[model samples]
Structures are given as structure tokens and as C-alpha cells.
Target chain A: MTTGVRRRMGVEERREQLIAVALELFSHRSPDEVSIDEIAGAAGISRPLVYHYFPGKRSLYEAALRKAAEDLAERFEEPREGPLGARLLRVMGRFFDFVDQHGPGFSALMRGGPAVGSSTTNALIDSVRQAAYEQILAHLGITAPSARLQLVVRSWVSLAESTALLWLDGRRVPRAELELQLVHDFAALAAVSAAYDEEMASVLRRILADEPSDGPFTDLVTRLVGLAPLPGSV
Target chain B: MTTGVRRRMGVEERREQLIAVALELFSHRSPDEVSIDEIAGAAGISRPLVYHYFPGKRSLYEAALRKAAEDLAERFEEPREGPLGARLLRVMGRFFDFVDQHGPGFSALMRGGPAVGSSTTNALIDSVRQAAYEQILAHLGITAPSARLQLVVRSWVSLAESTALLWLDGRRVPRAELELQLVHDFAALAAVSAAYDEEMASVLRRILADEPSDGPFTDLVTRLVGLAPLPGSV
Candidate 1:
């Protein structure tokens, strides 16, 4: 544990170290503004070694973004066994906390740039979104998923991300107050699942009470009634 | 109109013409990709004249954005005499249609370089958001609004914008379906106002039943509960 011990590190450790340093620097300045030389200087390593780890600034930024996305995914995955609404709140609470702790880095990544606007980073975000959607479906016990369900999930995620950004932007509300408001908003939105079920049941009852149907109109009405709320409803 | 007649216009008409041309060009290309010279060329005017009108590409973009913001404000100011939920939906429907018609131009302004990052442009967006918030408060008959209410409106706006973008991205859902879903979702969220009022009413009833004294807790609860739901709640 001596100051000069200089413990040898693994290749993976060095790569992570480079990404961490790069993320820290990218937060204060735009990607174009930060140079590999500065990253190397900050990390107490030679420029060549930094290159050996990341190949270039673009690659480094993408890697950092991927790492952060993974971290977020893991956070959401942690509280998976609770009631649907409570679980969602827990996951969102963690997410807001992450934004608060890493405000600059999250903002930089969320505000994408040209160099890092590749399919890789997008797929990373999509993965997180898809995972959350699947969790909601499972919690709801939705036997057959529909396109409407997908839209709802996407909309909710979009709302959560935008709200986090606003909260980060020095909105006057405290985090606890924001969290309470979100719980109410999100829970009410989620209640649409029950409402949709009720509406569908009523449509079915009316159809059954009617004379034999002649066309596809009855089926269409049933399907429509069962459809999920649109994206961003919540 | 003859060519000469159209060409000879007042300064205000010419400035408007320049902004229209700039908005058109911005729709076709990223803001950074479009140049002042190109805007001038597209407008059938000299670069110096374009500069005389807009000063630079940034200024030109800002002007176009301001025009869009003003249009939105005007739409929001339209008569909203109806149930609160219906009124809110009508206003949002107008917004969605506007975004649909001006998809590319709005996208350019929202996600464009410098436009998204510029403080001035962000301020313009904030101002538009404030106007929308005010309209929501007026519709709900909520006096002395809380931060929570503002957050709800902001969240709803974000949701509406995100939904419009998804539709513009060519999602399979029809605009009619999206609109219906939004209405249902909004109605559900708006229902929370009733719950808030009910909670306050119960607190008052309890306070009055227990003692004749109006304690601070009773007064606080009374004030909280007296906050009515947006009109039209059962």
C-alpha cells in the first residue's frame, strides 16, 4: 500500500481507466473539444498507451457511453420482483439518482454528437428501453403483446428521460417532490391497463348480446378496445 | 402577380420571404449543413441581402424558430371552452398537427446543431412551455399553481412532442389511433386532480368532526383539499 507501490493492472482495468478519465473530461467540454492528449495527460499515461486502449477519441466516447448504458440497465434490473408500480418507481428513483450524481456525463451522452452517432450507441439505448418494456409486460401478465404496448413503453421511457433532464437543468422542484409527482403520473398512466381491459370486456359483452354478427366490424371493435394506450400517454 | 411585381416588396415582406426560404432549406439539410449563401441562393437574392435580413445562419435559424414559437402561442391562445380534459386534448391535437405538417423544419430546430445547444433557443422553448403551462392552469381553474402542476404539464408536452416525432418517423400506427390513445391517457392523468381534492376534503371533514378549533394542520389540510380537480371530474 505504499505510495510508490505501482500495482500492476490488467488490460481490462486499463481500458476501463481510460474510459473513466475520458467520460470525466467529456463532461466539462464537448467531444470535439477534448483531445486524446489531454486524456492521456489526465490519466498519467502516454498518448500511445491511450491510443492502444481506445484507438481514437470517437471509440473512447462510444465505449464510455456503452459502459454508462450498461450501468443504467443493471440499476433497473435490480428491483425486478416488486409490484409493477413500485418496481417502476424504484427503478426510476435510481435513474434520477444516477443523473444527479453524473449530471455532466449523462447530459453529454444524452446530447449526442456526430462522431458518436453510430448504430452501436443507439442499439445500446434501445437495449435498455427494450429491457424495461419487457419488465412491464411481465409485471402486467399481458398474455399477448401488441404494438400499442410497445408504444406505451417507449413513450414512458421518453417521458422519464426528458423529465430527468429537466430536473438536472435546475428546475426549482426538489428530487423527492419530483419523484412523488412521477409516481402519481406514472401510476395513473399504468392504470390504463385496467381501463383498457374493462372497455374490452364491455365491448365483448355488447357483441355477445347482439344478433349474430355479419362482418368484421365486431372483431375490429373488440381489437380496438383492447389496444394499448399510445406512446407517451404516461 | 407579375415577376417584377412580386420582386418589388416592402422590407417586412422581404424579411418574411427570407425566413420562409431559410426554413425550407433547414428542413432539407441540417442547420450546420445549410449556409447563408445557400439560403440566399434559394431565396433568389444576393448573399448580402440575406445578411442584411438575418445577419447569419444562426440568426436566420433563430428567426424561423421564433416564428414557429409564435404560431404555437397563437394556437394555444385559441378558445378552449370545454371540459378541461377535452380542452387540453384539443390544444395538444393542434400541436400534433402542426408538428406533423412542419415535421422536418421543427425537427431541424429542435435537434439541430446550435439550435438545441444555444441558450437563446432553449429560452425560447422555455417561454413556449410556460405559455402551455399557463393554459393548462387556466383550464383546470387551479389558482396559485404548484411546481408539481407545472411538472405535469411539462411532462405532457414532452410526451406529445415525442409522440409526434414517433409518428413522423413512420411508425405503423395511424394518426387517428395515436390521437385516441393520447386522449384516453390524458383523461386518466387528469383524474388525479380529483384524488388530490378528495384527500383534502377528508382531512377537513376529520378536523371539523373532531374539534371546532381550526388548527394549523386543519387549515393546511383545508387549503390542500380545497384545490379542486380540473373541471369535469365525476
Candidate 2:
């Protein structure tokens, strides 16, 4: 490509282009198996120019992973003012649809080889997962965020992750059947939450009462308690 | 080691000994990272003898994994004829307790490293998970299994796997809190199953009316129909 054409492209555009190309490459092979040379060759750019954009393959991989995560999180974050159950079903439907459309990307994230040591890929996914958890907590009208919320969140996300992978792997279960099963699963989960909320609330109260003086650990504890069944649980 | 000592140990004893030693080594490190030489060295046996029992490292790793899985499955299969919810909680509790004690084995399986291909691990876990699923189905008195059962089995196993990993990795949630949450979660799951059963039974009745001939595709269709909700309504 001409230098003028390259010069006209802003950083964001170039980054997006690089991520698009890298994602395409990584989709076909494990991230470790894909090399900078291959990526640069595929993008029709020099190795130095690729380095100029991303410090290394690790950075490039992180950027691509982050982009994919952002895409996923955006789908879940679509505004909806409805009952918690309805909203959850809508988000789950979107999630299943996203997985169907981006099977390779979803597979790579869930079953990829050892990620490039503590990169943004994990943090991005964790942040999105946490956001989803918070959404559930909010929907529950959980007054105090408790450890129960964390467990429930973890359970739901784990279920969603495994189901998506199983379906993508060509399991015989139809999507509509899977969706209805999920709806029932979440409803049951909600029922359990209702039963245990009071007990969790008592635990949160005790934890708050026993709170220590200020520090990061204390902040964490306070935040956790806030998330518990008590007011300001997080 | 004396010949007398070796002869006294039966084949079962020797096989168990080999598996026990192999689990210790494999759990601490990836299969590729732990060489046959190391396993031999640790087991106080000749490398050739270790090879005699297990053909290769891959076989050794698979044996270790299978042994761990069998141990876990056996724990779940322990006789318990209580209410379905209570039986499930007992089985799940046993699962969590096992993971708490044997975190390394569970982590290794969850990591699903290069040594164990996805298909290999999936096949291994499938039988073990299927046993638990069958138990649940039997308790629910659901005849004629469906693809939905597979999804439920997959999701439940995944929840247990992810929870154990998170707990092992030192999630701040206290152990007692975690256990309580899981019990509640399982209860919710069972409630959903009860509701789904009603929907599935209605669907099954309708499909039975058509009475398709038995064939591979018919089996697939039967499985699919069994998984879905009734056509009339929930």
C-alpha cells in the first residue's frame, strides 16, 4: 500500500485493521502456533511496521482477544428495562447467537492454549464476567451483595460457557431446546436464590459488624459485604 | 526390592500402585513436563518396568486421568435413596469435597493440556458424567433419555469443575459459604428440572403419536423431541 494511504489512516483504524487480520489468523490456529511473520505477511505489512503498532505477538493477541471480549460484552450490555428474568433470557439469547456466529472466536477463548502469560485476554474476560455477575445481582434486587452472588454468578456463567462449547462442537441438541432448558435452569437458580437470601443476609451482617480498620483487604471485605444481602453490600 | 516382595503383590495391587504414583507426578506437572524417567525414578522402579505396565507417557497420563475420574465417579455412585434434591446435594457435596482434597488432579483435568486432546478428555469425562446424569434421571423417574439430559449433565459438570477451580485458586469466598451456595444452586437446578420434566413429558406424548420408525435419524429426532418443551405450551 502507498505511504500516503498509510499516513491517512489513524491509529484506531490501523489497530482495528491489525486486529481483524490477527483474529482471522488466530481463528485457524492456536495463538502460540501463529507467528508475527505470518500475521505481518497476512496483513501485507512489514514486520517492523507491525512491531511499531503492537510491541509483540503477545500484545497483538491481547488486543484481538480484548476486541472479541468487547464485542461479547457489548451484546450483553444492550439496554433493557424489564423483569430480571426477561432481561437475563434476552442476554442469554444474544450470547447463544453470538457464539453461533463467532464459533471459532468463542472456542479459542474457552479452549485456547496457555495464554501469553497474564495478558489482557483474561482480565478483559474477567471484567465482562464480573459485569454480568453484577447485572444478575442488580436484577435480584439483592440488597447486600454476598458470596452467594459470586457463587450464583459463577454457576450461571460456567453453565453458559459449557453449553455454548458443547453446542458449537456439534452436539445433537437443537438451539431452541437448549435455550428453553437454560430458561428453566435460570428460573430454578432464581428460586434457590430466593430461599437462601435471608441466611446470606445474616452472614453479611456479621461480616460487616466484624469489619477491621482501613486497608485494601478491608476495602475488599467491605465491598464483598456490600455485595452481600445487606445495604451497601458492595 | 526382593522377588518375594514383588510376587506377593497381585496384579491389581501393582496396577493401583502404578496409578497412585503416576497421579502424584502428573498432577504436579503437565504430562509433557513429567518424563517417564522421572516417574520411574519417583516410583523406585526400573524405567523398563514402568514401560512394561504402561506403553508410553500418553498411556500413563490417560491411566492417571481415568483413575482419578473413576475415583470421583465411585464417590457419586455411593448408595443413596433419599429425595432427589437431597441425593443431588450429597453427590455434589462429595464432588466438592473431593476437589478440595485433590485440587491438583481436578486442575490438571480442567487445564486440558496438549497431552490430553479435547476429544480424549471429553470421552473420559463423558462416561463418568453420564453415570451421575443417569442417577439423576433415574431418581426423577424419567424414562427415555434425551439430548437435553446431555446438556444438563454437561452444564452441571461444568459448574462443579469451574467452582472447584475457582475455590482452589483462592477465591475469597469462604469454604462454608461456597458449600451452602452450591447446595442452594443444586436445589434451584432440580426445581428447574422438575418444571422441564412436565414440558418434556407433554412433548414426548405428541411425538409418540406420530411414531416414526426406528433409525439413526429417528433416534436423533426422538432425542431432540424428548429434549424440547410441549408444542401446546409449558
Measured over all alpha carbons after superposition, the RMSD of each candidate to the real structure, in angstroms, is 11.5, 12.4
Candidate 2 residues lying further than 4 Å off, grouped into runs, are: A1-15, A21-63, A78-82, A108-127, A134-144, A167-184, A193-234, B1-16, B25-42, B45-59, B78-82, B111-119, B138-143, B169-187, B193-234
Candidate 1 lDDT, B69-176, residue by residue in tens:
888876676464534434555676788777766777666555434344465676777678778767766665566655544555567767776777667665666776
lDDT of every predicted structure (CA atoms) = 0.60, 0.61
**lDDT for B4 (candidate 2):** 62
Candidate 2 lDDT tens digits, A118-227: 43555676777877766666555565665555665666777877888888876576676566556556544433443455654443333223333432123322222222
Q: DockQ, per-model, please?
A: 0.12, 0.16
Best by DockQ: 2
**Docking level of model 1:** incorrect
Model 1 lDDT on a 0 to 1 scale: 0.60
